[model samples]
Target: MTRRRPRPYDRELQNLRLHVGHERQGPVPVGWYFARFSRHLRRGEVVPVTYMAQEYALFRTRGGQLGMIDSQCCHMGADLGRCGRVSEERLVCGFHAWEFDRDGTCRKIPGAGRIPSRAAQRSVPVTELGGIIWFWHGSPAPEPLDELDFAEDRRRHLYLAGEVLVCHADLLPIGEHVTDASHWAYTHSPGRPMTSVQLRDEGRRFSFLIQPADADDTRIYHFRPYTLISMASPTTAVAVPQPGPRPDGKPPRMAFVAAVSPVRPGVTLATWSLVVRKFGPDWLLWPANRLWAAFLWRLVRRNHHADFDILRWMRPVAKDLWSVADGPTVRAYRRFYRRNLPPAMEEGAEERVSGMS
Candidate 1:
């Protein structure tokens, strides 16, 4: 009899890779939820929201109230997105006829008449603040939204807030854009041209400072550690202006501050609040400003697309594999992540790739 050839290990190796990665990389701790958009959700409109860095189902009622619930129905685990609705204050499951209230209470069970006292009632805790909605995924204790210090005059600035197209990238890479100054010169060049780029000799050092907002003003805040600090207004002048012919010679207008919060491991809620100074009769520059805003949006959108591709294809690299960009903000974000995020023991002690370790 002919000897049988040995089976190739490719498929088995792939499965092993996936399992090890998951065991090493546990779920990100539940953080803040994007509650503002939840408030804006319309009836029949189901949006994916994140808590504990995992996705959840977010829905609104015809009466303009919001509810966050498990994405799946309790019975048979049907996707609530497929068939779910608000009946009174409860969410009715399309399959198995189970009903869950806003608080995740089992109010009614079909064929059973009423829900039993022993049945488990699990619902996400939700809160509303500053026109945003928030939910807790960890301990039952409620975290205060007021803890994030919004600028005093944060509301005064002209603001445009919305989300970007969903991508498979992790939230950290996308959020890091805030501190990535180098991209402005290249990725954003198509829309907003950059005259020069600069980085510290050794590398960027992260420094965080809080600037108070004027009363009724809308200011952007960076959340690091346990505090929220105001982001500085964009400067109007460039160190070295573009080499080409000057168009009015004025510095490129600062569009607004864009912030990304991880709703889940791979999904992020990006909020861009456009801030513009109001000029009395100097409205002639408004058109230019608007054009610049559109350009900046395009630039950022392209950058995100690029990152999406990278994230989808590249395997995870250990922290030592890459060096932080030479910038203050970038340095600060790395420090923040190191300090706040759980340690490898909590995350599962998996050895990183040689260079990255």
Candidate 2:
């Protein structure tokens, strides 16, 4: 008897199944994610980072280069983040003075002249942008961070909000919040109907515009996959509010980029980074820009409070319900998730992705 070949797995079908709120299970998608604020890690400093259920020793060497390696020292399983020191361009283990290069190779071992063949520690790819330190949670030779359209803007000016808040939430829901038009009225602005929503789908990304009934400002949202961004999980979202003209007759331009990273299964840390166009000289515009960005951060913080209250305890549940009021942008976002999913992850495993355990 001849056996028939099995059909290929359908990502679109899987996307639709999960879109309607079907319980999702599998390995989390691989991508860049915010690990810590760049300022917090000064030169020659080592910090501990726990994300995606793995611990890392994120360090800035004396030479001003960044590296992330397994937090544990192989000598005796000592926590590297707690006992390691950055020496010039390498991490020196305090336990036995075992030195490791950025590539996870053990170069020196104190007292003993010979190093073990398996004394090397695992290292993760890391980059710095927009005042955030990010690490890749997938395969080696990660994509370049400069590929992001806003890369220059983030690097040139201050982009981070002063405070980063941690919440018990899912990555997808938090990233898709900007595209969720229906909930704005009830969740963010009461009595202001967010009924006038328009969308422009660009396959990999989709932009939407919204004008609330009680507000004069027009809000625009850009949602896309976070494959190369400095701060995003599987998806990245940006929201811009176009308010009326200022006293100078020129409308102020600013955007809030939502950056979220999954710390574990259901817990995520989210923050808003402000991006503004420079108006005047650097000496004057720099301070003004920071103040303006800080003001906007407060607004974002207030708005997200409502979201945190609801998302903190919510689980990924599928409802056999559909409504046009949810808008096309939401549907497009669901499709985006379906197409961008990674292979099923191992269940209850220490090493969920490559370079992480």
Candidate 3:
């Protein structure tokens, strides 16, 4: 598909999160990545981050610890992220040399004789894991990254760090794309859909059985038939909690995982990763090699990037949803979002779209 470059939205609608109520953004989760991607930040550095619907400042201390607080300083409401400097594990305000410790306690005010007990700024918890820094958005402690147990076992698979890009759009399209199994038949296949979809782990994991190779079948989506039976088991195709276990008592061929965070109105940032087998063919089937893992990663990356243009501009509207079979799968996620996460926008603050109702 030919891709179109993203055009900027209306100026007034840029910071949609700031103006709109949180409820309209859909059950926007309160998990990590609000500081967008933070593993790159080092000590004594102050950076501004927009999370969910608000902007905040992140500070790194001397010993490689991170703290999240409001971007504006408590004193005189100065933009702390602009000129703030760290002083011995503390973030000092640029305007008045006000120093805040890793806990956000305003310990020093320079010439001020008395340090007010209320001078402290409330902070969100921060944790660095697996090269990504996670920060809690709400009051509770941030949950550690839901990493796969298999990831720790290096003997099984080799992981390739992939691309990270920011998009200006909503996530509903993404939710729809994954569940739209029919698209596989038209865009990625030779007019044949997936053969089976088995739910596992209380609907958290999935096992997709695609139609095996045929002479008439053309693999447009980069989905090659499993040449190796061990690496291509139908047991663990695409899962949420983790890919399903190999029924043949083996590891996965590769995995594609991506997440999108809505930080501003008409703006979002996402992270992606691909993992494959560390070694070449193990028990054998069709004489496959270790490079199969990397090949799968490239295919996954190509397939997703093909949709980037549409994803960046697709608006989340009820009228666009199409499906009967996949409805339950997509709705389940939205239901969980509504019940657990807060809405991303207020009803009145939503962007006024004209054509696409």
Candidate 4:
């Protein structure tokens, strides 16, 4: 039998490069918006959803319906969030008493001789799923929501979640922070010696393998309905596999899952979760777990602060202006960006022209 020659790693790297640049101005991929938690807008609350900094009124009906409409009253542009009221499942603009239904149709215009047919036509696309409100701004045509798949054994874990609005910074920078492993060495040192330096460095070499949830063959289990396992990277060849079923017989529901969405161009809503097994269903366990999670949350918060400082400085420049560090995962990420971002943006032509002129 003849043995085939092993494929070269450099060849794989070349194929994976995604040339991202800032010149081709269009909306970022819509995958960036789905499944993001909007905490300010409580259940059955109406709030404004802004894209690229422009506002659109978003609301959920008492019957568990979702809706989005122009933030201004069609008659006299009044800020809806400040002066709007939900009456009988319709959003009434306070300035001129214009009423819009769940579909964004102008249901009533008080004292108008006759409501124009066009008044009832305009509506923005919206979707509600798994405790999230999603507004589709790209096109009128609807697209299927991304589905999440979990392995059978992993499905038994319960999940817990929380959302916070950072005072500064956008979603992209924060999402990128998750892939940054070097920060853990210094910022997350916490006076403890690095026990997993090699693993950390190795993990950083992996790039995001985006696929439909149905296509992903990863395990996802959660401690609660809200907590979900998103994806997991395969173990490295050199690493020893930890024992399963845990010493306690109850394994965590989800090892890790993060769903980060860009609520608007400048603002981001990140929904993250941790899965744990039901520890006897005792009410006491809830508080105990929360306190422990809070400690972990603080560590994460400090690391985010460090990353925010770095990314905030780099945001003004095109991503192409940056260089990938010498690591397998970092190189893979650079390649992915190079291939996905438009050629013009990847070349930084926009920045170059702006500087020259």
Candidate 5:
């Protein structure tokens, strides 16, 4: 059998090997319904976006679809997000009254009385599901976004059981931890070795079963990594670029979902949906859920602290090492990124992001 090693020139992995701290690289994946922008943005609103190290304006049209373009208006360098309006499925720049469609095609120019030949805003494809907006970070695909649905019900996600964890770190590393089980002690550890950890990977999605090293250890953990595995448990987990929409429409509920979104060069946001179900007694569902919820929130917060302890300051890139729990899953994910997304817009690759190349 042949062993697989990462390409020698993969800069993202190389930087991780060299331990250069935190840097945002890699093309953001397609089909991810980003909830980070869902809070303040409503239909017919535009929000400035500086995600994946590129500048963009994410506007929700009245029809409830999302449209994206370079935040700067086509006429002058005014930030469209600051004073942008949506007229039907288009965005009207407050600066010049320029109107652009969902694909950034300029349809109305008040001054020119006709759309100029070069009056179009750069178009980025967008779709929405689960009460969240999603845009592709790669060349547009030929499928409609309604076909790209979220596996989890982002709309009805029980609020008491969930919280969003934001940090100034790129999302890839944090998202990768879901499959890297042995390292549980390094950060979210209970200060004891997990009895046994096993992983199963089925291409786009993978899961882990974490067990305490000893039954005699006899310690109960509020948030055992076990329940965070899939939809079967009272707990469920949905990671980004998670398994595509299910045919049965019964996507596994997630106990924790880390949806990654970029804010700027050195800042990133992850919506960590930590869902904790109530006790078996139906009567305890209300009053008891609160304290239990707080305990779960603390678990998530501590885990976040453990992650940010290094991620908050370290600029990390991928390093090709498959020596951890279910290493193949991590390798597969990295392969997916390198295969589907274009090179990260670094140094001077900004044109690629803005040009839709």
Candidate 6:
């Protein structure tokens, strides 16, 4: 029997590559992203902010209101964040002394007699809640935020466990990792695997409840959710243990809220805040919670740090080989992203298909 000569090395490799991988860029999800901590920006200070792969001029007016507008001055295209000053509740361009209102309407032109209709700058909607500032992306008007959801956080007696900032190369992996139950054991907890999970898919907000394998026998434990993983938008998530005395009578785990914004296609900035409910009498509550927050912070920080290297370098697989281990929570997260892709992405996909036809 004569053996045929082996196929050319390059051609064989190319065939294998075609069958194994073909990566394409996908649209990024956009919505309200946490921009900055409210305390970071003082009154009458204008600063440059980069988010959603674009630049913005963020400022706090003398009247204590936050304003975000297009960074480029409409008059002569000067960088507003660098050459802007806040005066009289308006943002004044330093280059030509042109003044613009918080709404981005050109109010005054020093030399020019009248402000032209096209001279106005584009304004972005910004709101501050619970000392966190959020900016709307992809639209001029912001969607309504549920104030009731954060009632406990706004309480004066609450304790802040401080903030964490992590830079990611790509955001999809981190977003999906928020609710990935199987990875909990290996990535964060090590041995305590996730035993039960409940997913709540609420269109824009996807949430899930996770219970560890080593959980105690607390009555109505399954019915009463322990932890909440909420996605405010595709880029923001709030992960916190449910508020209650622990089964062992220990203080509950501190809450963590992580918000993400894309600095560019492959770079994402994630901001995290750790919080714990205050306990004890009002006078002692502050000091006690402060100490408690410090302890809780260490616990949450460890888990967060474990994910840093993994998430930073992770790449999307061409095809996911999911298994039974990847439970309902992970499946729901994938389904949510698929069903609620950004409107721009949906439009582009349609255009591509139509052109092919």
Per-residue error at 200 for model 5, in Å? Answer: 5.0
Model 4 per-residue lDDT tens digits across residues 1-357: 111232232133224342223223333332324333433344456654444345566666666566677776666678664577666577778788788897878878889878887775256677644334555534326554423222122233343344333213354454545444444445644332111111222321332321112323222231111111122211101111123211222233323444444434444444444334444444657676656656655544554455444543434334334334322443343333233333445356334333311
Residue lDDT tens for model 6, 53-96: 55678889988998899888887789787779999699988899
> Which candidate comes out best when scored by TM-score?
6
> Model 3, stretches more than 4 Å misplaced?
1-27, 149-161, 185-192, 195-254, 275-300, 324-327, 342-357
> What is the C-alpha lDDT profile of model 1 across 148-206, one tens digit per residue?
22322333223334343343445555545555554543553333322212222221122
In order, candidate lDDTs are 0.42, 0.61, 0.51, 0.43, 0.51, 0.65
Supply the TM-score for candidate 3: 0.66
> Each candidate: RMSD to true structure?
13.2, 12.7, 8.7, 15.1, 11.6, 12.9
- Where model 2 places Cα greater than 4 Å from the true spot, the runs are 1-26, 145-148, 151-156, 195-233, 241-253, 284-287, 318-320, 344-357
lDDT of 6 at 314: 72
Off by over 4 Å in 4: 1-26, 32-39, 120-122, 140-174, 189-252, 255-308, 311-324, 328-357
Deviating ranges (above 4 Å) for candidate 1 = 1-30, 35-40, 44-55, 110-113, 118-121, 128-133, 146-159, 189-325, 328-331, 342-357
lDDT of 2: 0.61
Clashes of 2: 2
**TM-score for model 5?**
0.63
**Superposition-based RMSD of candidate 1 using all C-alpha atoms, in angstroms:** 13.2
For candidate 1, give the lDDT.
0.42
Clashes of each: 20, 2, 10, 26, 13, 0
- In model 3, residue pairs whose N, Cα or C atoms come closer than 3 Å (at least 3 residues apart or on different chains), thus clashing, are 21-345, 21-346, 22-343, 22-344, 22-345, 23-343, 24-345, 25-344, 25-345, 26-344
TM-score, per-candidate, Cα-based: 0.55, 0.73, 0.66, 0.56, 0.63, 0.78
